[model samples]
Target: MPNTPPSPRRRGTARTDALLQVTLELAAEVGYAGLSIEAIARRAEVGKHTIYRRWPSKAALLMDALHRVWTTDLDHRDTGDVHHDLREQFVRSAAALSEPPIGPVYRAVIAEAQSDPALRAALDERFLHTVEQRTLDRIALGQRTGELRADMDLTFATEILCGGLYYRHLLTTRPVDETAIDNLLDMFMRAYATDPPPPDRG
Candidate 1:
C-alpha cells in the first residue's frame, strides 16, 4: 500500500511542535531575556514571519512553550480525602515550580510581566486563573462532601491555600518543603474543615 501523506492539520501541528521545542531549548539555554523571534527562527531554520504568523510576541510564544513543558496536572484528585489530595497536588506543583526548565522559564515570564501589561494579563488569563479555578473546584467538592465547612468562602480559601506556596516559591528565599506544606494544610484545615482531620491510617 502507498503511504499516505500527512494532512495539513498534521503538518501544521508538527511545525508548531517544532517551533515550541525550539523556543524551549533556546529559552533554556539563553534564558528568556536573550530569546527572541529572530533567534528562534534562526535556530529553527524558519523565517521570522513563520513564527509571527502563529504567535504575536515573545511572551506569547514562551507561554505556549512553558505549557508544553509543564505536564503537571493542575486539577485535584477525588480521593475522598481533601487534605490528602490537596497535599499531593501541592507537593507536585511545588516541585515543578522549584525545578529547572519550568521553574526558570516561569520566573522569566513573571519578571517580564512586571513591566508589560499585556504579558501580565496573558499570564494571569492563561495560567494563574486556571490554577485558581481548579483549586476552588476541589475545595467546593470538599464542601459538598462535608470535609470542608459549607459556609466558608471558597475564593478566599483557594487564595490562601495556593498563595502560600507561590509566595514562598517566588518572593522569598524560604523553601516550600513538606514541613511547610503540612503546616499550611494544618492551618487551613483548622480554619476551614468541618472538624479536625482524622488521624492518618497505617
Candidate 2:
C-alpha cells in the first residue's frame, strides 16, 4: 500500500528544526559567512520552501535556533542561601556554554554581531534581554529575602558574575569549565556576597 505524507505543520516544523540544526553545525564549523539557505536545505534534506515558510530569512532561523537550545528557568529559588543559589546559577549557566557546538555558535554570533547591527539587535531582544532580566530578578529576590545584602548592587553583581563567562567563552580560547565557575563565584562572594561579621567578643 502507498504511504501517507506528514501534515504540513508537522513537516514544516520538522524541516525548520532540521535546517536550524544543520545551520548551527555549519555555523560553528565555519561561521555565518559559510551559511546559506540553499546549503542548509541541502544539509537538512528539506526544500528551500520549508525553510522560507518558517523563517523570513537566515538571521531569523539562526536566532530562533539559538533560542531553541537555550535552557530557560534554570535559576529560580528561595533557598535563603545566596551563595549556594549563585553557585548553582554559575553551574547552570555553564551548562549552556559547555555544549560543544553551542559555545562555538555563541562565539560566532558575538563576533558576527560586531558587524551586523540587525543580528545584534535580534540577539539583544531575543537572548541577552532574557538573560539579563532573569538574572536581575533572581538576585533581586535573593536581596529581598535578606540572603544578599540590602546594598548589594544587582547590576554590578550580574556583570561581574556573568561577565566572567563572556570573557572566557568568546574573548579567550579557554573553555568555561567548572573551576572557572567556582572561582568566579568565590571572587564575587568575596566582593559582594559575603556574610556580616559577628559583634566583638568580651
Backbone atom clashes (below 3 Å) for every candidate = 0, 0
Instruction: Give the whole-model CA lDDT for all candidates, comma-separated.
Output: 0.83, 0.72
The sequence of per-residue lDDT tens digits that candidate 1 reaches over residues 1-202 is 6799999999988888888889988988898788889999998999999889878888888887776555344558888889999999888888888777678778887887788899888777666767778789999988877888989999989988988777777788999999999999999999988866534433
**How many clashing residue pairs, candidate 2?**
0
lDDT of candidate 2? 0.72
Stretches of candidate 1 off by over 4 Å are 1-14, 45-47, 71-75, 196-202
Error (Å) of candidate 2 at residue 37 is 3.2
- Candidate that scores best on TM-score: 1
